[model samples]
Target: MTTKERHKVLVLLGPTAVGKTRLSLELAAAYNAEIISGDSMQVYRGMDIGTAKITPAEMMGIPHHLIDIHDPQDPYSAAEFQEQGSRLIEEISSRGKLPFIVGGTGLYIESLCYGFQFSEAVADEAFRKEQDQFAEEHGALALHARLEAVDPVSAAKLHPNDRRRIIRALEIHHQTNTTLSASHAAQKKESPYDLCLIGLTMDRKILYKRIEDRIDSMLADGLVAEVKGLLENGYSRSLVSMQGLGYKEIAAYLAGELTLEEAVILLKRDTRRFAKRQLSWFRHMKEIEWIDVEGEQNFSENFSKIRAIIAGKFLSGLEYTSEQYN
Candidate 1:
């Protein structure tokens, strides 16, 4: 493959409610690009509303891949996502179309962009059960604290409230007898793609408002009914998909653990926190061309700026450095 063919990827990424999907559709329309979703939740079927999946009508005849490819009960991981996403990227490029990856799943996007490697550690069901029981008995924070003692770097990077990752880190340490940070450091590999990463961001106040409005819209669009449907369909609360921001909060409301009003408020708060985490993850990556959406410009203007950047770097055969944009 030529240089352009090898590293020709366009990623539109930002926090939820930051207009990434809308702007990405416009860019795809302009370039006749194929979109491969980078969202984790969007891969599961029947998760449309909570995941904010773009409908077929909303796609406007633009082809999309990697959405609704699995059932919600199935487990999907970043490693699987990277493999599938890379395959889609190649397939789209083979058809002479630009492969545009768009979503708020920072880890999923980063795995593709940086080619992060997952260890060959198989899931030990017994071990996982033991850890779960320990967590239940000793609290999630205590388990995270144990991880902190062994893998301070990973612990420092992960939030204490991130029970999933904390447990995974501990599991890795227990199974491999090595810290996750060490394994992660040892597997620092270069990416196979030359990515033209476009990151959309807005003022914090504006972003918070948008997040609030989006939660309201989701509620108005029957988010509660959606979660209720999932539960009624034999889905478990412990399932990872059900633990997503809107799903879990609304599930609580349905279960009578929280009032509808309280659930909505909590959902908004959690979504904002999730967005902040997404921004933090993206900020740590140095390769992105950050576009401030609140810079007195509309989406079209901001997108034009992005298009010019991508064209200059990838299509125009100009070796533009990141410093030029900074």
Candidate 2:
């Protein structure tokens, strides 16, 4: 399809605990839309509390796709996300309902929106294992430096803390004898969707408070027990799903690696750091319209402001969903 023929998509994305959930549901219901989750972990079954996966009641009758579609042990990559998400976008738009992409996984969402095509060379398990082990022996930064040597262009875009993607870059160079930067630059990819990205932000202090409180609520909602249940069911702690924020900390406590109090403290700290990384990623992206909510603003007022933004961008000044008033 041509640029003028691209499907319109609304992307609600930001750091964790930045309040994408309630607003997304309200917009979807108002616009007669279906949602496609842009979260990496939300695709895993039995990984709810830690991922902060939405409940059915919270969905409010809007159809949601690309979530709870994988077992915790299965591997899911941005390439897979792009393929699946593209299909869902077309499917939803074809039905005359708006297709909304909601979540904080930057690569998955951005690649889907911009039509990123993955290199076709199969992953070399032996090489990946070697790189991962090297990261453990040296450090993520050291591994990232390897990416810098092989593909500085790719390295420039990746965070040192993102060990996995760094490894993938190295692996790409290893297998394809071509740098990741070269592949992506060769494509010179462009936006495949007529998309508007709505990014939420707030005071750093306030966002950190929200992150801490959300972790507290996750624990109270059986985060520890959830991890315990997954382990008892024979899932490995090394699985990517189990390495998530809440799950990893609780797993450390369960393994006698840390006391419960210590684990919780680390959990909160790590999550705050993760939220920082998330914001950094989104800040680097293009075409994002930001909404910065005040600490003192009431929820209803905030929701009204959000609705107005969406109405202007998506609804073209038409009536919005007013029943639940979320």
Candidate 3:
């Protein structure tokens, strides 16, 4: 590969519990790759079990970046993920190493993949304070309705409960004199690398089953205890990381807002819904190579299929030794 032709990056994206971790490790090992996480929640430190972060033992000695890189109180956005992830991709590719972006955070992945132009609009505290005051007095729905009036496109994409993003959309419009939706639309397709977008899927029943099983595994791995520890460490339930699938439910349980049984049920249901949303997001993205993962095919077999596709597309001449994946 020549200087310009060598900048190839692989993206392995799918919904939660789709077996992305194992395959990512195998592919990273086989291709002399470094893993750059595409997960949004996994960036928070001390958010291990609930996030289902790739544990050190599971990483198989491959270097991974962007996991556990942020505090739970810190506000990490897709724009931040884009800036940091783009840098990692360039550095990894320049060193003749493949950068494998793996996880289910669709917004972060897509923004970085398409080279979305992130506005340098910083948070306007006074404007945000006014927005918050309005929300406090008028309620979240009322605040969201106000957003709908000014930037209907952004309002349509953001949920009423997402006060932060709603305020942000309003903030951007107030500070930049431009609508958030218009800025997004104005972004050009200026990706700097050749991308191989590999999507993983399975039968709906199997995928839902996997989601349930993964939730159970997370609880078994002490997700409740993890939540308690975070709260004890002064992390508030209002923090963005605390609102993630497992953490939110468990936090509610710990606060006596719900019984343990109810929390578990809610977590499972929410995770399934999240998985569906992830699929919906990916469906809207262009140029993805979808591969249906069979339920019966174990790791080695699945690895064979994925390896073949990736080799044909990105690493045409890179010879992978058998021991590499072992």
lDDT of each: 0.82, 0.84, 0.85
C-alpha positional error of residue 140 in candidate 1 after TM-score superposition, expressed in Å: 3.9
The lDDT ranking, best first, is 3, 2, 1
Instruction: Look at candidate 1 and tell me the lDDT of residue 41.
Output: 89
For residue 215, model 2's alpha carbon misses the true position, in angstroms, by 0.9
Relative to the true structure, candidate 3 reaches a TM of: 0.89
- After superposition, the stretches of candidate 1 with alpha carbons farther than 4 Å from their true spots are 1-7, 152-163, 185-189, 295-297, 317-326
lDDT of 1 by residue, 16-41 (tens): 88888878877787776889998988
TM-scores for every candidate against the unseen true structure: 0.90, 0.88, 0.89
lDDT of 3 by residue, 127-222 (tens): 999998998899879999988998987786665656888899998888888998888778775566688889999888999999899888888889
lDDT of 2 by residue, 47-92 (tens): 9999999998888888999988999999889999999999998999
Judged by whole-model lDDT over C-alpha atoms, candidate 2 comes out at: 0.84
User: Sort by TM-score, best first: what order?
Assistant: 1, 3, 2
